[model samples]
Target: MGYKLSRRQFGQLVLAGTVVSGFSYLTNKALAQTPNLNIVGIGSTSIPTDPTAIPEVKTTESYSTHQSSVTTDIPPVGLELVLRSFTTGSTQVIADNGTPLLEPNEILSGFTSLRDGTLVVAITPLITSRRKATPNRLTFLGASSAKTLIVSGLNENQQLGSLLGTNDGRLIGLVGSKNGVPPITLVDINLKTGAISPLSQITIPKDKRVSNLAECPDGKFYTSLLGFHGETSLVQLGSNQEKPIVLAQLKVDGQEWNNGLQNLVCSGTGQLLAFGAMRYQTPNAVYSIDKKSGNMTRLENFDVTQIALVPG
Candidate 1:
């Protein structure tokens, strides 16, 4: 039971100060810097799939609500949907054509993009209200969908980590706990149906967590790690050997990237694109990490809060 924001309502939200924090300003700055880059927004006006779908609006009190919202810039048509998450717990699905749309819920966790151009979003419900606790639900959204699908099975205890779309067309999720107990890791989800198949947990090094996941052209996948000291590393996943192999190390401002890694996406080639800022007010950069050598090349810099690859 959400309402689509008209252009006037959008302005009111911005001027009246009801708009989420950090989102409107950052998104506008990002678009201004990348005038040629395409962006789009995606979200639902109604929760058609969740039977327990209740209309709950919790913005000021929600820790996960994304402070950022995208600009209304128009992009070329026929591009894939790119999803962006904000620290405020909001998630947005923008079209390659550069139109931004909003979802009612703040996706405190991360999201993933599929090869087919669909998006998988893990909705973070409001913490204070049981009527709005939307933890375990996943949303499948695309351009040509007859309707959006929202499926629930995720638990609050399952701290949802990286969401990756595998080459085999299966979507994989890394489930871990902050306290580090119940070592059950890795869940393979049925995209069509919100079914979960639990897999054996692999040992991730202590003091480090997965920052980003990206797949290569050869069908292998890569992951970026964030250490306790705010450093980042590239690693290869899924081989005959169970352990992950460290590939490259990345740094920002001549130091270990301490600002934090927000999202990682494949650049449509074999390389991986890492997006994050070292610290607040620091210019954000998109780094291209060579899959073979683990070398990171700075591609561009702007105020971009989130980024993704749209199908050409």
Candidate 2:
């Protein structure tokens, strides 16, 4: 339930519900279309952004605003899917033991899973609009209603957005800067013991803030693409001794760049999926990225409101 992002970075997109301008710019791409990966033509994705309407795939399009984000996945319980909304809403969880836990005025932002399959939800407690000074809260929910996460003291600062769990179940939150200047700083948290630590301490590169976070199957640090000016680049967390590596660069390809990666989450297994669209454009279609090949391909028949990864 802990997060890396301080309140400063979390200001950009509040959950998947309220999306802002385009983020992530590719390094370069005069020629489009990458090779050596699989490319299957799925249908098309359409958002309500344009006056003209069409299918979701096949035609390169644009998108803005998403209703939810896919953060983490626990095999049998479904991907840790989150629904977004400008207003506060509540959801109920029925633990395996059939204990009822009521979550109120909460924003379901991100998720992370432990090595043993326990799930940690990166959530910010819902405060009434009247309560503007409320600090963000992180809670841990066990896979079997073990117990929710508990943190001692929280300063009014520090808002968290996306989250990714380590192979050993350590939680990392994409933090926002609370003070002046550009927001969005990366930070990590230990869910098991509620420890707050700086991810940058582990050698993560800083710059051009992260819009989303997802773990690759290889047990790499983690990856999330950034977009701006019609271009995109996939940034990954590297070893403590190295810098954050840009796996798939932000480059323009034949006038097309993969812009705006909305929600990204990886199954403890090898599957990585993200939903987004062309830069500066309401919701786009879902995309399945090949973590191994740096391939951003389309995935059809996804429920934007609820996306869960089912092992094949």
Top-scoring candidate (TM-score):
1
Superposing all C-alpha atoms, what RMSD in Å does each candidate have to the true structure?
11.8, 13.8
> Each prediction's TM-score against the native?
0.60, 0.53
Could you tell me the TM-score of candidate 2? 0.53
Model 2, residue 277: C-alpha shift (Å): 4.4
Runs in model 2 with CA error above 4 Å? 1-106, 125-129, 132-135, 150-155, 178-185, 249-259, 267-271, 277-285, 290-295, 304-312
Model 1, C-alpha of 193: deviation from truth (Å): 2.0
Error of 2 at 289 (Å): 2.0
Candidate 1 ranges with C-alpha deviation above 4 Å: 1-105, 129-132, 146-153, 178-184, 200-207, 291-295, 302-305
lDDT, candidate 1, equals: 0.48
Error of 2 at 84 (Å): 19
Residue 1, candidate 2: Cα error in Å is 27
